[model samples]
Target: MTASGDGEPRPFLVAASLSGAADADWARAAAPHVDAAVLGGVALDPVSRAAARDLVARGRSEFLPDDPICWIDRGFAALADAPVRPGVNVRSATLEPVREAAAVCADRDAVCEVNAHCRQPELRAVGCGESLLREPDRLADYVAAAAETGATTSVKVRAEVPGVDLVAVADAVAEAGAEWFHVDAMDSERVVAEVTGDTAQPRADLTVIANNGVRGRRTLAEYAAHGADAVSVGRPTERPAELARVAEAVRAWREGELPAGEPPDRSEASP
Candidate 1:
């Protein structure tokens, strides 16, 4: 139910993106409950791979293997028959790997998501992840490189970063040809509205997906009220019941069964 009978995007969607755990098998298992699934968050290139290894040494979650291009190809190959829209969330310090990965995504008609949401010290120290938030021009360059490959490009960002203006970052990436803007709203769900509701220069073509603390009907309603085009589940993505609940809530909201003013509830929010 990710799209209409004519193959257009659905009114609302349940998306899931796993850091180190996402693979073809995970995507297949979760595909039944989600409309779209982003895989990997894989580290591409020498610098990013080195950063991933450091994170691994520190017991942080990250996808491994030195050959990330082959990994992206193989992962997408295994998901050729999957029902959900497949995407790869990637980390790279330079444009070469991003172009390489986005080329692979273009070949498969998949999404190439730039990782600007990771806040780990190791990732930031290497100019990957959240470090891009502080350098919007660099982040936009990554998005532009990905877009140049003819793949659907997305940028995953976070709010409440000390000196970063999330809306300006959104505009920069959007101007660089990003089709999707995935916002990890953290504790500021209203930021979704701000990004989507930018009246100065509306980004009508950018699809804004709200993440963090999204669980069931309550959170879903809250995000929708804040103008999020869709919602994504992160840490709780492996829980089938939780995915099912969120999917059901999406369906309810689409069908007008979920109230717009449903009280905010963070009891079941994911980390």
Candidate 2:
């Protein structure tokens, strides 16, 4: 259930995210490779977060589930009650929904995150995801509230958002009490990989995680060295066999054989 660990906690190191493509078969496929499974970005509406969160929980076998964004308006539409962990991929720090989402995350012992990486056209029009990283001050406030919830607070940010100051944003997230940060290095065409190079590692205060296109232990190791405390996977868990491969990747990550890339120096981890 641990998302961030010191030296290859699971050998492969996978934090699988369950998106619309998830199901028992998919969950079963990804279960073996992943230590924890997080539900993909939801509508931030409470109902959306709650329903999505429940689905993630059900799909995951034993692993803990953390959902993204608790769509405020979607709360009433939730098929289930609120989950302990709420998700936030909001771009506007001043949005009132952020406050509502924070409160729900606090009340539920759930982990809440700020999704600063989604670039969906509709999301951009609404100013969510990557757009939020531009305003560190407001994002920090939301992170603080989420942390105050007694649940692990984290932020999943999309990189290369132009005016984005990686270090400053990471520093802000840390100062606000966030324990984990999700760095999406994937390119738009590739779903966030290919663009990763550890540019944001230096700014984090707590555990740093790299997502977007982590394939095997080699890639995981390269990321870990670049200052990641952990790494996550998304579409790979589309089915049972793939999920098993995901688990095996975690085991390999712990063993120190990540998919080939720039292997980060195993020096004192940048806290």
Candidate 3:
């Protein structure tokens, strides 16, 4: 839903980057505390699914045996009546599965997030996750493919990748038609402002959501000051206490009750 008079989707606290094990029940549990939830980093196509299987064999948890498309549909179906906005984070070595999953998400009015943040060796080897970061044009192609389905498209990315310029990556995806830029600002919090700030001229308007270490008011306020449209909790997604704290913090920030540190000098904030 609209969070302000600007017609932008409300800045929300989300349960972020949960694994395939996250299902309807998990979404339901997180719904009480989060405005939105991203489920699955599920492998979508056969090649990626094979890679996922290899990962599972090496002790990774994934949505296996169940078809990726079906899994996404089932997850959304279960959340049909829930108050929380639903999103599916998907992984695939090919464009087809990305398009297919985005179609399901489109029909359900949910966000279709492309997983560009996973650093797993198996996933990276198959050209799925962080591998996409190094190939910005390819990543843009994936984002464009997902956007074609009429679903709200998001790309989950992380900072600190050697040789990768996140601002450039953000620009590429936004130009490719992504609506959401989900940043896992690992220790580099100010990068949120770098991407969200108005300095990037001719850049498509993007809803920036900062992820990582978002526990309560302080962290939430910190990202806000950095120009994040929202904040999300990653590792603590299952902890009710943590989730509640973040949810409340988000509410306070949205209502202008929390102090987001000094505004950056707009003149110096540039990509």
The prediction achieving the highest TM-score against the true structure is: 1
Alpha-carbon deviation at 156 in model 3, angstroms:
0.2
* Candidate order by decreasing TM-score: 1, 3, 2
lDDT tens digits, residue span 1-271, model 1: 3443223355456455677888888888888777777888999988888888988998877789668889888988998998987889999989888999999999988889999998988889999999999999999999999999999888999899999999899999988989888999978888999998865543667888888887888888888899887788876678878888888988887776766786878786765
User: How high is each candidate's TM-score?
Assistant: 0.94, 0.64, 0.91
Best by lDDT: 1
Candidate 2, residues 125-193, lDDT tens digits: the string is 455566677778877877776666665667888777788877677778877887767777653323222
How well is each residue in 69-148 modelled by candidate 3, as lDDT tens digits? 89889989999999888899999899888999999999998889999999989889999999999999999999999999
Candidate 1: where are CA atoms >4 Å away? Answer: 1-8, 199-202
- For candidate 3, the 10 contiguous residues with the lowest summed lDDT are 262-271
Determine which window of 10 residues in candidate 1 has minimal summed lDDT: 1-10
Alpha-carbon lDDT of model 1 = 0.84
Q: Please estimate how well model 3 matches the true structure, expressed as its whole-model Cα lDDT.
A: 0.82
Q: Name the lDDT of candidate 2.
A: 0.52
